[model samples]
Target chain A: MFGAEFVPLSLPPLVIGSLAAVACALPGNFLVLRRQALIGDAISHVVLPGIVLAFLVTGSLGTWPMMIGAAAAALVAVALIEAIRRIGGIEPGAAMGVVFTTLFAAGVLLLERSDTSSVHLDVEHALMGSLESLIWLDGTGWGSLFDPEALAYLPPELPRLAITLTIVALLTAIFWRPLKISTFDPGFAQVIGLPTTLIGLGLVSTAAMAAVAAFDAVGSIIVIAMFICPPAAARLMTNRLEIQILWSVLFAVLSATTGYILAGYGPLWLGADNTVSAAGMIATVAGLILGLAALFGPCRNRAGAPLGA
Target chain B: MLLDAFTLGLGYNATLVTLGSALLGGAAGVCGTFLFLRKRALVSDAISHATLPGVALAFLVMVALGGDGRNLIGLMAGSALSAVLGLWLVQKLTRHTRLAEDAAIGAILSVFFGFGIVLLTVIQTMEAGKQAGLESFLLGATAGMLKSEALTIAIGGAMSLLAVLLLRRPMTMVAFDPEYASATGMNVSRIDMLTMMLVMAVTVVGLKIVGLILIVALLIIPPVAARFWSDNSDTVALLSGAIGAVAGYTGAALSASAPSMPTGALIVLSAALLFTFSLILSPRRGLVAAALRQLKYRDQVHMRQGLLAIALQQPIYERLTLNMLGKQGLLRADGVPTDLGRARAAKALLDEERWRALRTLPQFEAAAARYDGLTDLEQILTPDQLTEIDAHLNRPHGVPA
Candidate 1:
């Protein structure tokens, strides 16, 4: 049944999830184009130790410290991968496997050793977020937005995600030219004095920030899915960078909203009593969208588009 | 205390788990050599993550069929099937569509894990599913392993080891050069599939021990570490197996001693430690060895250059070079080239001239082995004639020297 409690419980997650999805998908397009798609997965995993270390130092799970720590960790992961590849002559994927797993294992060990009960930060929650419990019911209906007390009662995650998404959008729009040039043709971009390396690093750091912001709400798995799937699907649907970005945002928002709704209510419709993980559902839905696009999209048979382009 | 723990201080279950994990690690290392050679390290990661949903589905089916849902064979069968399916999807996505291998791998990994999480949530809601203990598949729970499970791992490990041994020739052939294998009328695809099957078997069996997230570390770290020690594929495979076995044994023993440590992470960290050691200190292809070789080569080149300069009547550049060459009986103390030094200097000068000429010629650019063809270089050009040829080559294409 359409109950009063469902609307208040489901709305905030849907909004936060979509925002996180859009934020991640923006930078994901560049990563896919540059053939560094797995870097997102690597960054997401390596940031675990950073988040845990930040919590240890600050004694609180504040956004700035965690974001800064996670960004630093992601950069360290990237640097280590490069160093291992150059020094040891190991393949990039294997180098990534070595670094991220060790970092993640260290994070897990640290979390287990520390008293994480007070911080509500455990390995399980780090991998799979508690989206079902993010209920926003401080005040009911649209009238509550104007009330000062109700405004203060808004779910903290909503604002953090919104601000992160806005920064991603603004930076993406401002640097769209260099990002596109560097991603498509770094040699030419360098020849023209575009600071391609700097742009590339900035893009990766932005992705890390988005990843850390989304980690608390949707978990790292969903963050990785959003980072690759929507951009990849959008890539299959379009060739122009602008249209691809729009399509990516569109696919991400749709997946987030639809996956959240389905996770919350789909099981009930199927005569089950419990809801599933919304973050996992979002990733699955994003994947499903990608599968459909890969099959039926106009660029499906274009061999050079996805990776080589 | 450590000796006792390694000897027999632990109980029977702990000892059995340690031995079983060591066997599993050995098999995984041997199988991983081929995968690493083929550059499919991340593919194993994808398959491991993709097995999660199959595990959940198998448990659900077993429960439905009046079984305890913990049947290891049934669960492994389901996991293998899904992992192969995931591999097929990766192949299809890469071959038929425009997605690169990494994108395909990332897509399959996240999606399958997502579905598995959904199924896990569903299972948790069921009546007896809390006892399923499937969450251990994420990070592994070696402490909770049963004797029967340990036995199964041992048998599975031995079988995979036998498979790798039996198919070593074809797997190595296909891994290093598939085109050559196919050219020689071998079924490269079938060999590749067989290797995948062996990998799948080891991976599925290892799920209860190392879990999905860290399982690829077992597949990757050992072979890579072994590569630092030897160039022969057979030696590499053998050393990888040995390193993996030692890592497994020590990690399990340590975990048994310290009950608080997670066995999977400890095992991976141990392998990583071995990898670091090999990377820095292996006798061949290691950083330290390479740096030492570079220094020795530099010294030899410096002595030879000094001899050549002295023979050519150029001013001596370094007193250390002169003293070192004199100590080596190649140079006179008066800074003049000795007869032995003169012969060596003339040979080195001819070699340099030949190298410069060959490098400047674009026709010889691709053939690195062509340098060996210049055997009569001394008869070909004297020092004065070498200068003339060098000047001629350095001039503009249409201009006279």
Candidate 2:
């Protein structure tokens, strides 16, 4: 449907989105097994404060500083949430609700107070990253080797995406067994002397970083769509961990491509100014797929069933 | 201050918001009591997020129908309709699919919120000027509250209270033990649905106060906080409602004074802080009470050990009078052992090494009788303090005959 010009425009979003998907999926596999599926929701909202704080200090969207800061704040949030659960005797879900919402509120207030630009680089940018702009940046200089051999020089972001995905792959490979055991049965894993807390903290931080990465493609709110939807959908199709991870990755990649292509063409066909956010559309699509899976998956119990017979 | 707050001047608008939010908070508490018992504490959360699309669509329809874009009726109708749809979808997905309840909630929440965002973006483009006021529902805008909204909240709050009063007996029975109620042929699903509807209604009422995002806190924190104060279920529910109302009013007032303060967060923080206090100092179940009980028990065990040590030093041949017992460190040197002194000196150690077996039983009586050669001091110790001490001592022996 698109000319050669549009194909290249679509490639960066797809590439970055796939990297985000892979990153979110690796940790999300365990998050689901740990029954912390909604943890992404908490992390998405909670990381806002750190992003705002980082921007206040740096006054720009420098990725590493903001990412590192957000990751740290997310870790603090996780620790505080755990302490609230243990010391205050609050339920996990409620504790999460309290911590994340409070942090998000603090972030919003901080964003308003910061004398930064009117564009609201803290939350709005994080939620709707400049995927459109990032996809078309000029790859100049000796960056020629990083180019796609046949088509054109690769965007600098392509290599960053690769590095992020590589990090995710390496971590998942090294910690696969411990992560799996810990996710499935934390109590037993703790009894066996596995450092469940460290693993848990690592997973939470990785999810936050995945959120930062996805922010560049889909934005923050839709990052929840990336983190939760595919893992949830994969859960319906399989009980085996390896299979679930594979299916999750596959679904995420497909959703990203579909979303990118659709966003590229959707506004054009409707006589609009390409205003439809690629990341937001992709998130919606992911949610749609997950919703369908939840409605048609093969195994269910009747006792706490959603609807009456 | 009260007169100024209720004066019918320009300040009346703020009063409406305060009172309406307070009433809504009470209603949420009553509905939440049943939810907590049902172990369905997360249902309100699901409904809160899932209602977003409903509100957005309602606004869309309002515009489409040539109605005023800022009408509250359109918004309320939209929320009710969408909430029902979300609930129905959740049910259908759970019944026909393999999804767990939590999974179903997650799916509904994401899809509905995402769709709501899509609609919001569409509407924002189409009706940018008129959409400014509508954003309040997303983050709550008590500044926009009027007398009419307050009246609707009052009526809804009253209806919720009346419904709880009517269903109190059945709800109590179901919450305390749902399996028993089900086995007894109570219409469990009907009761559950009705309760969920009340919870949904409560959430709808709270939309103006805490907004769409944070209403779940209203439904969760107050009732749990109240649990620490009262052992009886009815009292807990009642106290929960009171606490919620107080929190609601205070939050609105504080939010009015503090610009840029989100009302929902303030309200939830107030409730959370109150819960912390309840956890520490409530009379029956508070940490302070439990700690004090432990301290008292330890003192009794120590005192009993002192008396037993003194008694064990006595010869088997000699019969020691109450006066002779006073000479040992177990009692005061006074001829007549006071109730406190008798309590300290009559420590007959348990035969079993289990410290919990150290009750005021005949083992103590037998040892005392051996020392006094048939005195009736054991029978003299039938006081209330002694009875509790006895229970604590005999805690290991399964309620002590």
* Each candidate: RMSD: 5.7, 8.3
Per candidate, the number of residue pairs that clash is: 0, 6
Question: What lDDT tens digits, residue by residue, belong to model 1 across residues A214-258?
Answer: 887888878889999998888888778899899999999999998
| Model 1 chain B poorest ten-residue lDDT run | B367-376
Cα lDDT of all candidates, in order?
0.83, 0.68
Give the docking tier of candidate 1: medium
RMSD of model 1 against the true structure = 5.7
Error of 1 at A288 (Å): 1.4
Candidate 2 CAPRI category: acceptable
Per-residue error at B122 for model 1, in Å? Answer: 1.2
Second chain of candidate 1: TM-score? 0.80
Instruction: Estimate, for each residue in A106-143, the C-alpha lDDT of model 2 and write its tens digit.
Output: 67556645666754474446655666665443433234
lDDT per residue as tens, model 2, B284-303: 76778878998776655544
How displaced is residue A8 in candidate 1, in Å?
4.0
